[model samples]
Target: MGSYIGKTPTELEMAGNEDEEDALGFKLTVLRDAMIHLRVQFLHFQSFYEKEGLENIGNDLKAMKIILMVVQNKIEELKSIIPEYLEIKNIGMVKQKIEDFDLVVTEIVLEMKEFERDNFLMEKVEKLINKLNPFDVPNLETLDQELSPNEMMKTIMSKSAKKQQDKMNKETIQNDVT
Candidate 1:
C-alpha cells in the first residue's frame, strides 16, 4: 500500500545477498507473473469449457503441474544463491540447518504455489458461484462447534502446550517448597 507498490523488494528485506536479491527478485517476479499468467490461462480455459463444453482437460492439468514444479525448483535455486547460515557450532547442526532451511523454503513456496492454483480457481469462481445456487452452500456455518465461532467454539489444548504448562507449574511448586 505504501512505497513497495511499484518498487522492487529491498535487499535487506530478502534473505540472500544484495546483488543476488536484486537479480533473483527480478527473475522471480517474472516467473511468478508467468505462473499467475498460466493460472489465468487455465481459468480462462476452464470458463470457456464450462460455459461451452468439457474438452479433454488431462493434458492441461499436466502442463499446469509441470509449471508448478519449475516454480518450485526456482524457489530451491534461491537458497543456492547465498551462503547458508549456521545457528549451531557443530557440523551435524549445520547439516540439519541446511535440511531445515530447505524444508521451510519448500513449505513456503509450496504454499504460494497452491495460491497460484487457487488464483486460477478464483478467476472462474464467479461462474461457479452463479452455477451453484444458495442450496449448494452445504450448511457448514453450523456444522461443528470447532469450525463455528458462534459462542460455542470449544478450544482444544495441544498436548505439548499442556505438557509445558504442567511442567512449569510443577517447577514453580517445587521452587516454592524449597
Candidate 2:
C-alpha cells in the first residue's frame, strides 16, 4: 500500500466531491467484479467436471453457484443501502450487509474445499473465494500511506528473532547428539 502521507480518507472523499458518498463505493465495485469473475470461474470448472463425469465435484460447483447468487443479491442490497446510509451517516445496515457477505463467502470457501480437499477444482474455487472476500477491503484512506509501518517492522524483527532462536536450539541439539 502506498502512503497517503498527508491525506485523510475524509480529504480524499472531499476531493472526489462528485456525490458526497463514502468512498466505500470502490470496494463495492471491486466486490461485484470479483463476484463476476468467480461466477465465470465456477461455470468453467463446472463444465470441466461435468465433462470429466465427476458428479460429486460438479455438485460442489453447483453449491458454489448458489452461494454466488446469494452474494450477488447482497451486493445489490449494499449498492442501494450504501448511498442512503451515507446520506444519513448511519452505516449500521451497510456494515451488517458487508458482514453478511463475508460470512457467505466464508461458507462457500469451506463448503467447496473442506470435505473434498483433494478436488482440484474445488481447491481453486476456495482460493479464489478467499482472495475475493469483500470484507478484505483496502483502506483508501491509507492508500496514500503505508497502513501499518510499525506493525510491519515488528513482524520483520520478530521473524529474525525466531530464526536466530531456532538456529541456536538446533546447534544445541547437534552438540548434545555429538
Candidate 3:
C-alpha cells in the first residue's frame, strides 16, 4: 500500500481552525475506508485458510465477522449524524458526535487488539488492526485528498476491470498450454 499523507481528525481538531463538520466528515471517511479495508482483509484471510484446508479458522472467522458488523453499524451511525442535504440540524451536537465517534472507535481498536493477540491468524489480523488504528487514519486521508468521490469510484471500477481482464488472460494462457 502507498503511504498516506494528510491530517488526521485529531490533528484537525487540535488545529482548531478546521470546520467541525469537515473534521467529522474526514473521520467518517477514514472509518469507511478502514471498514472496507478490514472486510477485504478478513475475506482474504478466510479464503486463504479455506484453501489451505485449515479447519481451525472457524472461530477466528466468526470473530472477524462480528468486528465487521460492528464497524458497519458504526459507519451507519456516523452517516446518520450528518444529514444528506448538508444542512446542519444541530450544530451543538457536532462536538458530542465527535466524542461519541472517538469512543466507539477506541472500543473497536481495543477489541481488535485483543482479537489479534488471541487469534492464530496473527500476522493478517495485526495488519488489519494497524490499519484501523486511529493514529493511522492519515494513511486513508491521503487517498481521500487525492481523489474526489466520483474519481475514486471510477478508479475502483477500472481496477476491478483490469483484474478481471488479467484473470481472463491467465485462463487463456492456461488453456493454450493445455
CA lDDT scores, all candidates in order: 0.42, 0.55, 0.52
Report the Cα lDDT for residue 48, model 1. 56
Between which residue pairs do clashes occur in model 3? none
Q: Which segments of model 3 are wrong by more than 4 Å?
A: 1-19, 84-178
Which residue pairs overlap in candidate 1's backbone? none
For candidate 1, write residues 1-178 as lDDT tens digits.
Answer: 1243455556344434434434644544544454454455456656654665534655655565565466456545644642442321232322322333344334333443554464333322333223322221112122221333432221243446645864786487457546
Instruction: List model 3 lDDT by residue over 1-178, tens digit each.
Output: 2223587877765455335546665656666575666656666655766676555666656666665666656556665654541444332233233343454455445555565466344443444354454433322234235445764443345445755864786487457546
lDDT of 2 at 11: 70
lDDT of 2 by residue, 73-175 (tens): 6566665656554443324434544554565565565656553676344544544465555444433343234436653443345445755864786487457
Error of 1 at 69 (Å): 1.9
Give each model's clash number.
0, 4, 0
Model 2 has an lDDT value of 0.55
* TM-score versus the correct structure, for each prediction: 0.33, 0.38, 0.34
Better of 2 and 3 by lDDT: 2
Worst 10 residues of 2 by lDDT: 138-147
**How far does residue 26 in candidate 3 sit from its true spot (Å)?**
4.1
Candidate 1 off by > 4 Å: 1-18, 48-55, 82-178
Query: Residue 154's C-alpha lDDT in candidate 2?
Result: 38
